[model samples]
Target chain A: MGEIVFQKPKSLCDVPLHYCPGCTHGIVHRLVAEAIDELGIEGQTIGVASVGCSVFTLLRA
Target chain B: MADKVLMKGNEAIAEAAIMAGCRFYFGYPITPQTEVAAYMAKRMPKIGGTFLQAESEIAAINMCIGVASTGKRVMTSSSSPGISLKEEGISYMAGCDLPALIVNVERGGPGLGGIQPSQSDYFQATRGGGHGDYHLFVVAPASVQEMVSLTAHAFNVAEKYRVPAMLLADGTLGQMMEPVSIEGITVEDHDKSWALTGTDCKRKHNIINSLSLLPEELEQWNLERYKRYEKIEAEEPMWEEYMMDDADVCVVAFGIASRVSRNAIKAARAQGIKVGMIRPITLWPFPKKPLLAAADKVKSFVTVELNMGQMVEDVELATRCKRPILMANRVGGCIPTPEQVLAQIVEANKLGGAQ
Candidate 1:
């Protein structure tokens, strides 16, 4: 078997994503999670979730 | 102890907040209070603190909510119009029971009112300026020295009660220069067990939120908050009584109007009018006890204010309308002078114990 490497970033939670299917919000959330993981800031991050669809951003995590 | 130094009221408040161990300040610049933001911008970096001039008053207050949820001291300052913009976040902070400081160095306003000293925001500050059953611990400082002391006091009380607090000043208080000593202001520590420090997967995550879909739970939250507010009302109402004894007339005022009232009161005393003043230091608690007590001894009341009869309503409520109340007021960026207040005192004295 090929070496397994790709996985969800630790900063991204294990809960099911609430975004609409095929929505780019999930993609953006992943990118943000990746950045926090790469910078090793998961333990130091404080997300200010705003109103609207983005309000659920931190709640899922 | 430090020597008294000349400082603007806005600058004194900023320095006093830093003295009280507040390290994070978020604000947007507005007239008469922009100096607070300017001072924080210059000083926060040197003290290893954070100062961010957010894009708007709303953004600045939200940043305060963010920092405050982390169990860190935070504050935001704005004028009247800007404060109206911040009311939503202020309500959220109250609903979430987060401790933060909000300063409204008020300018006249029903809508984008002129940038002049006015106490028109009294109702907004004291009555919970947002759309909810919540109250901010509101303090009105009459002088630059009180500005220094009350900044620390507001922070301490906010932390102690886990509620937002407001330092309600006006354009005159914000712009006027006075000799102030910002020494010996101590910051009391409070528990932060509910703070949103990252869990590191060690425990259940803490959520700092104001939203609740369930009506029963929301009702319970508000009830619980009011219980705390009741305790605050019982214990925290503060006012200064100047020559209240042996006076036939009592003048109630706060902030700059109180200053004007003092001069009017002295002049009235000289004229044998037997008038005194009660200056409320905490607007929310409203200093009802003293005013109610004075109602028994005084025949009439005069409320001096920079707004058109805002606090006069509070005075009537506090005194229970036991005595006839007169309002000496100026609105729309205008302030009542000592002579104007004295005239009201004379008018109240003429009523002469007539219910």
Candidate 2:
């Protein structure tokens, strides 16, 4: 079997992002999650979601 | 008894909180409470704890919320105006039922009032400060020893009840030095099964949030929270009564005002005026039963505060207005003198033909 190298980051929650269209929050959030996954810091990472469009970040943490 | 070491109240609270197992502290420096953050900043790094000086009180408290959501003990400290700035975050914590200790080393306020001691935040601390019908387990410490003890106690109480707790001290208690022993401070554990720990793709994910968009769901959340509050109010009211066995006038106070009231009570007793005092340790619960019971024996009540008669209203309500309630208050960062409180006690002693 082929190695599955392009799966979703384990740090990313299995939920849909609430970002509006054209918003780069999803991209940034995915990159942040990818970084956490790459760094193996998912269990210790705590995301502080502020007000505005990023408030839903905790939902996807 | 453990040996006591002299320490400032702010540093005592910080050290006691560390002893109480608070590993995460996020705060911004505000006068009268900067020592707490400074102490945490110095000690947390050495002890493998996290200490971050946030940009603002709002951000600091929100960071507390973040750590609290993960079931770790967290705290933030501020003075009056900074506490006001963090009110929104506090309300969110209340709504989310997150357990965290919020220390308010109060200064004068109505707007950046002064860096001096004041209890003007009485209503702010006791009445939930934020825009909601929620209550923070509010503990007021009058002395540096109580500052150390209550800092530990408040953290335990917050975790036990799954509610935010505030250590409501003023600039006087914050800066005052006294012999304090943190040896007996112990942290109690509670079930944090609902905390937002990562699932590791094993069990279901826990969502630590306060957003209930449906009106019915929101109402249920508030109702459930108030049910817990009702239990807290019943079981958690703490107070100290001095010379109340046979007294004509009852003085009600807390924090620095309570410390001053004690002196006045002693002087009033010396002069045969028969004055006693009820010092509320838990300000929110207000110790209504004791005040109400005292209303039957005392001729009147005198509430001394650093604010313009804030706690006097609670005294009246708690005592059911069965006796006349007088306010001996000073605003603008002024504390009431023992002589001034004694005068109010004498006046109260004369009410209802008690003199």
Give the Cα lDDT of each candidate.
0.91, 0.89
lDDT of 1 by residue, B1-355 (tens): 7899999999999999999989999999999899999999999999999999899899999889888998999999999999999999999999889999999999998899999989988889998999999999999999999999999999999999999999999999999999989987988988888899887756777888877767998899899999999999999999999998798999999999999899999999899999988999999988999999999999999998898789989888888889999999998889898999899899999996657
* Per-residue lDDT of model 2, residues B1-355, tens digit only: 8898999999998999999999999999989889999999999999999999998999999889889999999999999999999999999999899999999999998999999999999899999999888999999999999998898889888998999999999999999999988888887878998887875656666777777557898899999999999999999999999889998888899999988899999998999998888999999888999998998888888999999888888988898889888888888889999999899888887788332
Error of 2 at B161 (Å): 1.2
Report the number of clashing residue pairs per model.
0, 0
Model 1, docking class: acceptable
Question: How displaced is residue A34 in candidate 2, in Å?
Answer: 6.4
**Model 2 global lDDT (CA atoms, 0 to 1):** 0.89
Q: Model 2, stretches more than 4 Å misplaced?
A: A1-61, B353-355
